[model samples]
Target: MKKKFLIVVLTLVLSLTGASSAFAYDGWADSKQTAYQFQFPVLGVSIVLNSATDVDWYSYTNNTGSPHGLSAKLQSPPGLIYDFAMIVGGSTSYFSSDTPGGWVKVTIAGNIAPGETVYFQVRGHTYSQFSTTAPYNFTITT
Candidate 1:
């Protein structure tokens, strides 16, 4: 009886750990130093806000030979809104969704040169609903 109980407890713990990790797909780190490295032309990466104050951070490097335009867009679930921020070559720009759950795109007005790096930050809006299960799709283009 003791061995059976221990086995059942261990099984339940393992199952819960796996289930929790399954929802963490594409989650970014909270700080710029430990931000996720983003590749060019990222399409439809699913991410969750997790909480009201949760912030996701990403960094991308320009690998092209010449200067190129860069843009980032996001689509939140219905009834949710999101805020986006970008830092390119020491300049910062901010963007937010005009309509709830609609796609919002932020384009860098200036072109980024080769070997430059851009950092991004994403968070739920002040009045937005946060969810761990419901994710928003994000895209990055250059």
Candidate 2:
């Protein structure tokens, strides 16, 4: 009886150790890196700027079949002097009325169809009157 009870206790301890080892092997996915490419045939999309500092102004122009626009909302931390303009094909077109604060939205007007690509030129100064680099997340959905 004593030998049988010892064997049973040893088996239970080994099972519990195996279970703890499985839990220790789990890992979380990396959020900062993208796992997949954007899907094609996207109707519209939004670009979120997650910057360590204020974002300098940026520009984006669409030449697809439908007109495209860009909007932004300033988060807490240092703000930016937002100025944006777009030139579709050739003509210069201004989209922003006033300097955007908090959140700003700018729309690009042009014919954007499938396969065509857009071009953008963004320039702005941060609250520190210096250039800042920010990670912009663009999500295009059909």
Best by TM-score: 1
> What's the distance in Å from true for residue 48, model 1?
0.6
Candidate 1 wrongly placed segments (more than 4 Å): 1-22, 25-28, 40-44
TM-score of each: 0.74, 0.34
lDDT of model 1 at residue 132? 81
Q: Model 1 over residues 1-142: C-alpha lDDT tens digits?
A: 9999999999987655321221443344778887777653342367788887788887888787788887788788678888888898778888888788887887775588889888888888783467788887666776
CA error at residue 39 for candidate 1, angstroms: 1.9
Worst 10 residues of 1 by lDDT: 17-26
Please provide the root mean square deviation of candidate 2 (C-alpha atoms, Å): 16.0
Global lDDT of each candidate: 0.74, 0.33
Tens-digit lDDT track of model 2 for 1-142: 9999999999987655321111100121112121122223332222323332422222233344565443332221134443334434556544322332333344433354444433332233343422224222222222
lDDT against true structure, model 2: 0.33
